[model samples]
Target: MPFVADALTATYKGIPPSFQWPVKFCFYNSLIAFVLGAATGNVSQVDRVWTFLPTIYAAYYALLPLWPSKSPLPLYPFVPETAHPDVIRNYSPRALLMFGLIFVWMCRLTFNTWRRGLFNLKDEDYRWEILRGKMPPWLFQMFNLVFIAFMQNVILFVIAVPVQIAAMQQPTGLGTSDCVLAVLALLDVAMEFVADNQQYAFQTFKHTGKKDEWPGAHIAWTKTDLKRGFITRGLWAWSRHPNFFCEQTFWVLINFFPLVAPEYPGYAPPLPLGAGTSLESLFPIIPGLVICSLFFSSTKFTESITAAKYPEYKSYQQRVSMFVPFLTPVWGLYLTLLGKKAEVDMVVYGQDVALDEKKKA
Candidate 1:
C-alpha cells in the first residue's frame, strides 16, 4: 500500500466514528481536560492517558480494510476507496514503507506494554504514586481526569502524526538503505523482546525462590544476605541498559526509512555530521532520543535513592557502567577529566600566590 494512505488510514483509525465529533467538540473537550489537569497539578496523569491513544487509533485502522463501502463522509473527507493508493496518483513509495514500519513498531510496543500489566482502565503508573499522595482527593481526581487522562492522551496522539504524515509520502521502490533499515528494525524488535524476557524471568525467578537454588556461584549477594540487585548477565552484560539501547536504536532505524525514499533525498545526510536537514528529517530521531534521555536521568535519580537506601550502591556503580557496556572506559574518562580540572585549579591558585608575593615585594 502507498505509505501516505496507510499512515492516514492508521491515524483515522485512532479516532473511531463512534467518538468522532465536530471540530469544536475536540477543541472544547481537550481544553476542559487540560484545565482540569492544571487545576489539580496532575501533569503525569495526562502523560499516562496519552500512551493508549495509538493502540486505540490502530484498532480503528485494522477495521477499515473490512469496510464494504468506499464512500467518504462529511466528517472524514480523507478516507480513500482502497487500501493502497493507485500508482497513477503519484504517491511516494518511501512514505508507504515508513507507514508500514511505524505500524509494526506501534503494534510490537503496544502488545509488549499490554503484556507487562500497563493497561488498566483506571490504573496509573507507580511513579505517579508519590505525586498523587501529596495532593488532596478532589485536586488529584481532577488532575487525573484532565492532565493525566485527557490532555496527555491527545498530545501523544498528535505528536505521532508525523510518522503518519511521512508514511503518506512513500516512494515507488525500495533501495539498499531501505533493506538495511528493515534488517535493523527486525533486530531491534528481537533485541527488545530478549531483554524484556530476561528481566521478567530474573524477577520471577527471584520471587519464586528459583534464583536461590540456581546452580550459579558467581551471583553476588549483599552483607545482609539479600541478592545484590541488578541484571548482570545476557544482554545486560553488553550494556547496562541494553533494552533501552535497543529501543532507542529501533526508532533511529525506523526514521531511516523516510530518508531512503527517492523523493526524500533531503532526509539522508553523510556522517560524521549526520544530522537531519529539515524539521521533518528530525522526526524519527526525536522519540528515541527523548525517551533515552529520560531513562538515563531517571536511572541517575533512582541510583541516588538506591544509594541512600542500600549503602552498597556506590560500589555497584563502580562495578556497573551506567548505559554503556563495561565501566573501564567511563571511569578512565572521569579520572582524566578530574585530573584536568584539578590541574587548572592548581595553576590558578599558584598564579594568585605569585601575585600576592609580588605585591608584598
Candidate 2:
C-alpha cells in the first residue's frame, strides 16, 4: 500500500506545489467533521462536503494560472510550460469545462440533498444510523473516524485530481477525443438527472399519496405495494443503481481527458512539458478504481437493508444487473448452467435473516 501510494503520487508530475492548500483544507475539514460527527452523533458532515469539493478543486485549478504572483505557487519541478510548443498564454480551457460541469453537478446534488432536509445538522444519513445500531459504540466511532470522515474525503479529492491534470496540459487545440469526452460526460449527467428525478418523484408520491402526478414509468409501478419499496421502471429497470453507474462513469471520462491528448500515451501519466511517456501513466486510473470500490461497498450496504425490507427485491436483484446495464441475463445464465450456484443472490446474506434481527444486533 505504501508503494502504491508513492506510485500514485508519481503520476502527478506537473501539478503545482501550491495545490497543497486544497489538500490541507480537505484534511482539516475532514478532521473537524470527524470530531463534530462523533460529538453530535451525526455523520453527515462528510456527506455535505462531498458535492462541493470537486467544484472547489476545479475552480482552484482554473484560477491558479491567473494568480498574480509566481512566488506563491512553485512551478512543477519536473516540467515547465516553456518546453511545450503549444503552451497557451492563458487559463486552460479543459479546466474551465471541468469547472462548469462540476459546478452544475454540485448545484444539482446540493439542492436535492437539501430538499430532503439533509443539510440540517440534526439529520443524519439513514445508512449511518443503521450501521451504528449493528456495532458497538466504540467500534462504530472508529469506523466513522477512519472510513466515513477521513477516507471518503480522501477519495473525493483523489477523483478530482484529474481536473488538475487536465489544467496542467498546454492546450494545442481540441481534438475528436475531447468532443467525445464532452458528449459522454453530458450523457452521464443526463442519466444521473433522470435517475434522481425518477426516484424523487416516486418517493414524493409514495409519501404524499399523489399517485395521479407520478412521473415517467413510475405510474405503472405505483399500483402495487412494491412501489413503496424500490424503483423498477425507467432508468432503474436498466440497472439497479443507474445513478451510481453514471456517477462513476462521469469521473472516469473526466480522468480520460488528460490521457486522450496525443502528447500523453493512453495509459501513461502526463510528463514534463517535453518528456515522453513512462509506465507511470498507468497510475492515474487508480482513482477510478477507488470510486468503483466505494460504489460496490455502498450498493452492498444499501441492498442489505433493501433485501430485508422488500421480499421481492431478491427477485429484482436476480433479474436486473447490479452496476452495468443489461448484463443480468448473461450473469444469470452463466451461474445456472456452469457454476451450479444458481440460488445465490447477487450478495449472500448472513444468518441474521430478519431485518429486525440485524437491527437488534
Candidate 3:
C-alpha cells in the first residue's frame, strides 16, 4: 500500500505539503474527466464533481497537519498526539469553519443537481449541446479539453486556495470576524438555496403544471408567471440570476475569512507589496475574482441563449442588475429615464400588467 501510494503521489513531493496532493488530484481529475468526456461524448463530466472537489481541497488544507506519513490521499489523515488541539482538535478551525460552510454549500448544490437528474452519467448541460452546434467539431473538442476539463478544475483549485490562507495561519483561532463571516457565508448559501429552489419550482411548474414542493415554493406561481418564460418575481425580480450572484459572492466571502481575522496575523485583502514582491502575493483574492470572471462570462453566454429563446429576456436584462440585488431598481430607473420604463416594466412585471388590464376590461 505504501509503495503504491508513494508511486501515485511521487510526482508531487517537491510541492508544498499543503498543495502537494491537490495538484495531483486536479491533474488526475482533469485527465480522466477529459478522457471520459471525449469517449462518452459528454463534456459535463466536471459538472458532476463540481460540488465535491472544492470541499475536498478545503479539507486538505484544514486537516493538512493531521496528514499521516503513510497515507495515499491526504484526506482524513491520522492525527498525532503532539499536535495542538486548537489547530485541528479536528482541523484548522478557521479553515475548518470554511470547510463546514463549504460542506453545507456542497450538500445544497449536490441535492439540487441530483433532483435535476444532472447526476446521471449520460446527462450533460443543455448549454453544452447548444455550444457544440455553434463550434466546429475539432474546436469544440479543444474547448472540452481546455475549458471544460482543465481550466474548470484549476478554478476549483484556486477558489479553495483561500482556505490555504486559513491553513497556513493555523494557530490563529476563530474570532469575531470568523463568526461574522460564517453567518454571512451561511446567509449567502441560504439565499442561493432559495434561488435554486425557486428556479426548480418554476421549472417544475413550467413542465408539470404542479406547484413546487414546500418551503421552496415561496411564490404561488401562476400561468402568468409561466407566460414570462423566465422568472421575474421573488429574488428574480431583483437580480436576473440570483443563484449565480450568490454562488459568486459565497467565494468572495470565503476569501475574506482569512483576510480580516486579526488573529490570523498580518493578513489583509490586498497586502502592501514591495516592488520586489512576486505576483504570488495577490493569490488570496484570485479565487473570488476568477470565480466572478467565470460567472460574468457564463452569464453573458447564458443570457444570449435565453434572449434568443424568450424575447422578454432582453428587457429583464435592461431592468435587473446581473449579480447585485440593490442595484436592480437603480438600473431599472436608468432604463426608465432612457424611455424604456414601460416596455421593460411590461415584460418584467407582466403579471401585474395582466392584472391591471383584466381589471380595466
Give the best candidate by lDDT: 3
In model 1, the worst 10-residue window by lDDT is 16-25
Looking at candidate 2, the ten consecutive residues that score lowest on lDDT are 75-84
Kindly state the number of residue pairs that clash in model 2: 2
Give the poorly placed runs of model 3, Cα more than 4 Å off: 1-14, 72-90, 263-277, 351-361
What TM-score number comes out for model 1? 0.57
lDDT per residue as tens, model 3, 156-267: 9889988877876764468988999999999999999989988998898899898766455567676677888788877888898999999998999998988887754554
Per-residue CA lDDT of candidate 1, range 1-361, in tens?
A: 2673455445554442322322223334455556655565544434443434443343333233333334354233133443344322444445445456556666666665666666543554555575567789788777666655554555444334334334444445767877788878787777776777666556655556454323222333222222445454556545656677776676656555554555565333221122344654555455455555656766776666667765545544554466666563565467467665344322222344445547769
Candidate 1: stretches off by over 4 Å: 1-93, 133-155, 158-162, 210-226, 265-289, 297-310, 326-361
What are the models' TM-scores?
0.57, 0.77, 0.87
The full ranking of all candidates by lDDT, starting with the best, is 3, 2, 1
Error of 3 at 113 (Å): 0.7
* Cα-based lDDT at residue 40, candidate 2: 86
lDDT of each: 0.50, 0.69, 0.80
Which one is best on TM-score?
3
Number of the candidate with higher lDDT, 1 or 2: 2
